[model samples]
Target: MKIIVTPSQPYSDQKPGTSGLRKKVKIFQQEHYLENFVQSLFDTLVVPNDAVLVVGGDGRYHNRQAIQTIISMAAANGFTRVLIGQGGILSTPAASHVIRKYKTFGGMVLSASHNQGGIHGDFGIKYNIGNGGPAPEKITDEVFAKSKVIAEYKISDLPLVDIDTIGETQFAGAVSDQTFTVQVIDAVQDYADLMQSLFDFKAIRQLLASGFEMKFDAMHAVTGPYAKEIFVNRLGASTDSLMNCEPSEDFGGGHPDPNLTYAEELVKIMFAGENALDFGAASDGDGDRNMILGQNFFVTPSDSLAVLAANATLVPAYKNGIAGVARSMPTSGAVDRVAAKLNIPSFETPTGWKFFGNLMDAGQVTLCGEESFGTSSSHVREKDGLWAVLFWLNVIAVKQMSVEAILKAHWLEYGRNVYSRHDYEAIPTEAANSVIAHIKSQFSSLPGQVFGSYTVKLCDDFSYHDPIDGSVSNNQGIRVLFTDGSRIVFRLSGTGTEGATLRIYLEAYEPDSAKHHLDAQVALAEMIRIALQISQLVEKTGRVAPTVIT
Candidate 1:
């Protein structure tokens, strides 16, 4: 084999977001589009001698081709070994775990989390550092800078290695006197073993043995195989309890997001009034986000994080107690109250797992989560969907109580944070910017303004100063705080491929147990109305209702 150096030109739109670079499948299929970005990343990295690299994706469209290209490039780029998931598949969290488990230089995760999948649907790629976490902004910035001025890329002339089977394939170096290796592995084994080491499998097995029924929805995405291995083969769950547990390149013609809007089938089963199952959970496309539910009840992600922190001692790994907790700014303050009760510090950072990675690496936080149906602990840098489900199961086994009962008891002790998020997706970029601009125009006069039972106390764009690194991240989101602990937050999301997404977050603290049973929509009706009025969202964007409500 010989090294091939091809001249290439830069693509101006290669800047990555808090997540990574995401675009429509057609955009990535362009000549040298994916190659340019990957080569830019390689150019920005300092490869160590005999360095190992991990490569995998969610088995979406174009995944195999992208992996083949990356592998050939790795050999030419001086990488000694590459560990890839069998059949070119690996969930985001699983890829992160593999990177940390093997101490690889870094890993490339090819997944557009919770996005649609098809020939015309979304695709993405991100770099995870050796810490098993998303690359910090510093590295991403350098990669972006390199991408802007890249002139060529390096690749080997060797044939593509087989990624369908679990085995190792070796080849001579393209330019050096070294050998390169590609090893395909069972993606579920390492992640499952880590789960067993963290929770009490025996107790959970007993709970299932006692006829405790539950259901897991993989939404035809990557988590299908992981759930099958962990919940069925390991935990003895019947195959009937798993829904959409088949991997699909197009996600079975459905959006693989685990929200109530997309996972309606699971919602119907869990909220069947009386004949509902004991528990129900669903994971997103790449298996990094999770939604938890009980018989006739839905648990908000904010509440889920608080409840987990409150009862983390039930699990064997966290039996010694947690160090601290952190949450994204858009998430509710429920976890803060739990942290106060546990006497552990709580941190609020901008939206991203990299921020939490910093705190965890410094031994400042053990559990961290975001409100977008994502939660996790120190066990893995990225959010683990199956791990969160197992954690809830372990807690249920220890308490020997129903999911509703546990949540009610938690609310009785820590009070309820009635919260909801409204997403207006795929709107024109200019329209979304108009809404933000309109909201910001009133920031100067909104403070001390009175509106019904709520009075505005603060209004500004949220910013964060990282305590560990002292780096400041500004323009996170817009916030309007009320004296009664009610909040309205507005931000433009970068997760979508087309246009822009305007997200409005409404939250209110309810300390009274009597009002805890009210529906979140009803509890925050006034606040939502005020939020719409303040931002003039409908007038600015011509959207009568949000695309999805959570």
Candidate 2:
């Protein structure tokens, strides 16, 4: 095949956010748009000799075409081998595992990650380093800089390889002496094996056999096959326990976020009157986020991390002990309490997985999570939805208790951290900025003020100082702390493709065991009102109520 050099213009909007470069499918379909960004990323990397590349996606619209384009470009860019998942499908965590298990130089994960999928929906691509973690800020910044000035891109005039079969295909590269190979492998097997090695699968199987009913919803995206392989084929869960397990290009015309508002079908069944299953869980598009429930009881992401840390030794992987723990800045202090009780260090960082990557690589933390339903340990870089669910199952099997029982006991031991997040989505950019500005303007005078039953203790924009690399990330979010340990946070979410997303996080500590059963929204109603009033969010955005509350 011959190498083709095509001239292209730079697109200033190619800069990646906290995750990756996400945009509408139509934007990616523009002439040389996707090629420009991919080539820019390649140009910033120093390809090692005989280096391999892992490539796959969440099976969304344009995934197959994008994989083909990336493969052809990899050949032209001197990659000796490319290992893609069968049928161009790989959950985000599964992709991370494949990159590490194969010891590839790097990998390209194609996903919008919980975003809607369709011709008019979102598409995204991000490169992960060899350590199976998202690329750090230095690499992402360099790629963005390269994208701004890119003038041309290179591709090989090679036919698309068969990605549906589990086999290897070889073809001559642009250079006569170079040969490029493509291997299509079963995406679920390696990840399942990894899970088996880490957890006590036998105990989990026995628990299921002993009438511990459960339900798992894949949201019609990636992780359907992986969940089936682990929960059904390996753990003996019946087929009826699975929901929306078939992968769909458009996610069955539903938003693929695993939240109360988006995963309504699963939530309804899990919260059914007296007929609910023992345990219920759902994973989002690309399979990186999870929502866990148990017989009408919902576990907040903050409490989930704390509970996992408190009982981590019950699971085989963490039986010995844990090194340390970490959580995002906006996350409640529940995990910190667990870390304190365990005599382990706990870190608070900004809202990206890359920060946790640095700490994990340095061995400073064994488990880390964010408040947005994302959780994982050092087993792999990205958050694993199925892995978290399996961890909970393993813990349940060992403890021989229901999910609600475990949570109540946990709250009784360590004070409950009542928490909720309210999201105002699709707000105009100018209005969102105004809301943030309104909050920041009051930071000087807001301290020492009294609002209802709470008195302000501090106010500032959240910032993170990386312990491993000594890098500083400033202006992460706005925080208003009250004297009673109850606080509120305001942030502009970077994951959405439409207008800006304003997220308000509310948290209040309750040490009384009797009050642990109170609804989170009810417990923090005063703080939520104060948060909105402090930021003037409703007045500026004209949104009387948030788009979603969780």
Candidate 3:
């Protein structure tokens, strides 16, 4: 009934990155490749024999097959129950809610997360803790270590499970009298319930009832069904408000990243001038990333975090006032000002969501976000796209104002931070590292030096000492702060699947409301030039311009 097979050699390259082990579908389809990694994850966890293993994915090309394999292996490895999303569809946030709701022994999520999805595109698998958040770096390290020395994997010879049907199916287990059970759940209910509890749905419905126009682009990815269920069915929005609300295995041959580059269709519709909708939003693959747009205007992720922080009391979940806030290092400091005004602690962690785990667990922060089109409160562990959309809608509903009007009022009250990030993707790893090293080496001599209009006020390699667990992470990034409150940071991205990605972040504060209307690129043009000269990015990577800008 159980098949225990030894892998001839360990997989040296199975190290999990910031998210998970992502690779081409071909890599996962190789004989015993998926099994080896799954076994390694199981071996790293202290799962009980009768524990339930929640399994699901974004419904990508390899998601169904991967789920079947995971179910079989779960049975062989001692799990007595598995609860999965129907049709192998589960957004990242929904999967997190499921795990926490069921109190399972963690869970596995199959997703590449905003990456392209096809035969040659990327696929991924990650383990989530019982708190509905990603496993901390400590657990991921153990899983990666096990992957290097894994010798064998266990799997059952059970037939492929039918994930489409929404009910329970039982099978014989290891013992003669034992039977394992699999439950297929409605993917949208639990998370929608969470949203309902957090916001004033009646207000949102009333706003929608008043003939407001909004468009939600799901990008042919996992959020389609969930968005349709919540926005159209639950709210009073018309059917036409949803775009590409269908889950496709290859995401219709498109990258599902909800950015200006990937969600061009939504961008076009939202910025269509006189014909533009009142509001526009898009969610990335697996539904953890989001892009919010007002009529003919884009809301940068940094501003979104700050705006949410400034007005968090408007939402029901945060009406009692938020405890604190945390953000990635490269994210703009707008929220920091909000925290200061509230007299609450604001933490600056490294570029990964896992870094916020300790802070959140210690109840030091109520909201957290990143510059990468991601935002979330303490509602769920991972950055949630739909939850963010609802928050915006709730704000608009209660304020009875346009998205742009809200932004203007907020900026007028609390100065604006013009922020942008440039990404050099798929460069040589050696070259990317060189750029970081070059910038870091300049830190010692950068202080008191002048670069064009900016005089260096401080220079250092950013290091974070966890207040909750007392762990230290060093060399997270290189930050150069000017005397005038402007900043430039350089770091190599950990979420890339290719050679390497170098990220340069630019931010400059503008206290005068009159100057708030200046273009972001125009305002930071000098800082951008100085950053290039300081890091020698163009010479090192031979990239005259960034592959993407956000």
Among all windows of ten consecutive residues in candidate 2, which has the lowest summed lDDT?
171-180
lDDT per residue (tens digit) for residues 336-386 in model 2: 999999999999999988789988889889998999999999999998898
- Runs in model 2 deviating more than 4 A are none
Model 3, runs deviating above 4 Å: none
Please, what is the whole-model Cα lDDT of each candidate in the order they appear? Answer: 0.93, 0.93, 0.89
Q: In model 2, what are the clashing residue pairs, if there are any? A: none
lDDT of 3 by residue, 1-550 (tens): 5555655457888888788888889988888899999998988896687899889999889999999999999988889999999999999989888988888888899999998898888899999888888887788889889988887888888888899999999998778988899999997888888889999899999988898999999999999988988888889789999999899999989989998888999999998999999999999989999999999999999999998998899999999999899999999999999899999999999887778767877788999999999999887789899999999999999888898898889889889999999988999999988888888787788899988778999988899888888888888888899999899998887776889988899999999999888878899899899989999989988999988889
What is the lDDT for 199 in model 2?
97
Better of 2 and 3 by lDDT: 2
Q: Model 2, residue 477: displacement in angstroms?
A: 0.8
Compared with the true structure, what per-residue lDDT tens digits does model 1 show for residues 1-550?
A: 6889999999999999988999999999999999999999998897788989999989889899999999988888889999999999999999999998998999999999899988999999999999999998889999999999999999888797899999999997765578999999997899899999999999998998889989999999999999999889998889998999998989999999888999999999999988999999999989999999999999999999999999999999999999999999999999999999999999999998889999998999999999999999988799889889999999999999998899999999999999999999999999999999999999889999998899999998999999999989899999999998889999999789999999999999998999999999999999989999999989988999999999
Residue pairs whose backbone atoms clash in candidate 3: none
